[model samples]
Target: EPEALDPRLRAPDLVDRELSVGLPDAATRRALLERLLADVPRAGDVDLGAVAARTPGFVVADLAAVRREAAVSAALRGAGSDPSEQVRQSDLLDAVGSVRPISLSGGGTLGSGGLTLDDVGDMTEVKAALTEAVLWPLRHPDSFARLGVDAPRGVLLYGPPGGGKTFLLRALAGSGDLNVFAVKGAELLDKYVGESERAVRELFRRAGEAAPALIFLDEVDALAPRRGGSTDAGVADRVVAALLTELDGATPLREVVVVGATNRPELIDPAMLRPGRLERLVFVPPPDAAARADILRAAGRDVPLADDVDLDALASELDGYSAADCAALLREAALTAMRESLDAGEVTAAHLATARRAVRASLDPAQVAELEAYARRRSDG
Candidate 1:
């Protein structure tokens, strides 16, 4: 919250409220946000974290989402109105009643995991890029300062669906001391209007609190769908507003990394992908042939197979499958051997035949093509 640093962004009296809502105390956190929101002004833009100073650990994304719900209910009422019957506290209250705040990502996306460079395998280019972009800047903020360099607000991860986007993210989270906050795009969905807007605020708030935390939004297409494509009218607007404000203006403590992943990267709004917003976009392509053997060996090492089982042949047979798909196939094979108790003995080439025959590929050609097409439609990233 750079606004916190600037002092120029806060109001004179403060919002004069605390999250004091009580709904059977489902979660002490949400209940508190509800209470704080109760005293918030009925109108005007809200700076979530600023508003939530007293409600530490409250998920701002959930609050933003609830806010959207409030807006929608206000819209639905007086559809046939006398135009001057202005939206009121009652309307906001009604929206609140109808909606439920998200309970997931106690912080933000990626569930607050941490990591360093050692946990990953074979993502040489990616590790190099991350170290340069994420590590070097933090390690030498002074160097960056001398160079007149400002850190990136966020990074967008896009790629072939099974190319280890999630795995890479996990590895990033697993790496040392990087406070990871993972947000689920699906959690942005809400029953009412103001809710989504509030969730956006909550996301930034939590991210700020968990400074030096990496906020990972997996399948970000759902949270910040492309401007023209979003079905929810005000959602894109509020999400964009909150997200851009935080990323572009907020002074995140040195350790925070905001990463969003999407299979349909093209669907994330332009403001989100812009240079000043999520400035870095790293595309993870499906593993090339060179990576296939490594992926196979990693997934297959634990399986009890006959010594005669040809790993190279097995890898060859699974050509075109993504790392995830390859793992699924290996799992399917091993499971079959376990199930049939075949030969009451070692699983062999004959066992491999059974597994191959029994297992169907998780992703079909058409689906793969669709994912590929979506990747192609996005920018150089």
Candidate 2:
């Protein structure tokens, strides 16, 4: 509806005056927040103006999400036991951390209708590694304290493209009731000077405020590419430096964990992979035959498959295929069947075979070898 209207329709004769809605300023956001929270019980420390200033471009829905998150936090903190208990300023700040800005990359907050480990196809080793690195520390803090060992600060998931690295991170995020700020690495890079570093700082500050938070950085290579001799005027280097400071600065990250995923881990700076930084490196390989079958079955859950279709056979045929590749195969097969006959009863093995022939696997042998070698080096370390 906001798209450009036809010239004839835009004329005063056909349409009335148009009013453009822009992002609310600080004062307007404060007014909106006050109105939205009128019925909600809030603590004396809760400042609507502060919340509004923090949320510059938030809309009505985002403000509503903040209120809902604050209420949830209050309930979790034993607010139900006391009828007079109110949502505190800290709860509102944490809620802001959970309610992502409208202009930010990625989607909704994790653990809010997010995918769990069960939703991901078989990746037993990968899942176990993630659990050990993230979930175990979060769920069993006392265990680490007893052993006098520091839990890993960050985890780096490196793998082939579409091999479910990001999916695994999402499952980890959903495993517990944690605040997750998901962002693409390249999205952090800003054209303006100092903006990227400031964004990084703000991101970590929010994560710290929302303790038990998970900052999932997808495509980390773009964010922390190997520094020195950079042509982009050191923007990437500055961003990486800022990220390093956030990860292992004088002020420690109490309960927050940074998870970074990338296909090219070698491109990431060495500083990021240090012991106190993104120390734990987990390799996510391409899906095996079993995982491929699982992916195919999951992808075809809604589609009507013919009895002649053998998922195991299709899986076996999809050698070197990633989970995404398997999904594409199923979609292509469905389309092939539809093209053959509009009234086709269901996707048959023949259709699948045609799709297999048409769509080749996307994995490059050289790249796979490189990833394997990288995994070996990490394992050795």
Best by lDDT: 2
Among all windows of 10 consecutive residues in model 1, the one with the lowest summed lDDT is 49-58
lDDT of 2 by residue, 1-381 (tens): 333467788877878688866556568779888899999888889988888766644667788899999998887777558767789999888888677656333343444355676767777888888778876776677998999998888899988998888777777665544657777887889559998997888787656645556788889999999999579999999998999999985467767788999999989999899998999998888888988888887768778999998999879878978888888888999999889888877998889888988778898889999999989987887
Please, what's the RMSD in Å of model 1?
Answer: 16.8
> Against the hidden reference, what TM-scores do the models get?
0.64, 0.70
> Residue-wise lDDT of candidate 1 within 163-265, one digit each (tens)?
7778877776554334456767877766367777677667766555544456777888887876666566666667766677777756454446677888777
- In order, what lDDT does every prediction score? 0.62, 0.81
Number of clashes in every candidate structure?
54, 0
**Least well predicted 10-residue stretch by lDDT in candidate 2:** 103-112
Q: Model 2: clashing residue pairs?
A: none
